[model samples]
Target: MKDKPWRREQRFYSFSTDLPTRYADMDTERHVNNVAVLTLHAEARSRLHLALFGRDEWLARTHALRPAKLQTDFLEIAHYPGDVAAGVSLVSLDPHQYTLAIGLFQDGACVGLQECRIGHWHEGAWTQLPALLLDRLQRFGLTEDVQ
Candidate 1:
């Protein structure tokens, strides 16, 4: 079978961090619920932002991001009382838009995958990315055009 795209992305991960699967994150089945998966993605990406741009830069940024598309595929059940980590990669980048790919892993196995397109809004319009920021993004492996 053809390899999934995100599988090739592990090496290019911009950032990754452990994320506790709180008891509240589990559903009736005792596995992580779908909504919590989204939270994990957000947390991972936020951590990246904090690391790369710092809190002040992030807070003062003028671009407002709106989710354009979100695709999630659940591959396996993620059980609690186990190790969990989140990995994030910049799949596409634009001045006022970009896409991120995230993975939720439990016990060293990927349990969920998500790819989301976040559109940027600046001054009531889609803005172009500054050259320096674009260079940084490319360094983080956003080597292709925005999708």
Candidate 2:
């Protein structure tokens, strides 16, 4: 899916964190690898989830929040030796699944945009999101963007 018009704006994200680019994250071309850029988004999302749900609870619910899908749009090349500002915003949510929008920025420009859908499951079928978890998600979600 395409990113929203406001996805590149840092203010659009409710959660923002800076991650340092490592030499290993660079490719032979001297640009940060695409996979490494995705990894930055993963770290950002993890931090957001951890902040929404404390350590103990996050661990307990880890198995249920399975990654259902991931779509990434590479916007620009990110060079090494600089920090990438990773931002995450909640895009949509339902009883069984929710979508997260992530943007990776370097030198104040958006380098990539990614959307991840997480499905909540119990036993062998889709399950409703826990009351507490849902409440926290709503609270931490981007007010104007959450659906």
**What are the TM-scores, per candidate, against the unseen true structure?**
0.79, 0.90
Candidate 1 similarity to native, TM-score: 0.79
**Highest lDDT scorer:** 2
lDDT of 2 at 98: 86
RMSD value for candidate 2 = 2.1
- The numbered model that scores best in TM-score is 2
User: Candidate 1, clashing residue pairs?
Assistant: 95-129
Task: Supply the global lDDT for candidate 1.
Answer: 0.70
Clashes of 2: 0
Residue 111, model 1: Cα distance from true site in angstroms: 0.6
After superposition, the stretches of candidate 1 with alpha carbons farther than 4 Å from their true spots are 1-12, 130-132, 143-147
| Stretches of model 2 off by over 4 angstroms after superposition | 1-3, 145-147
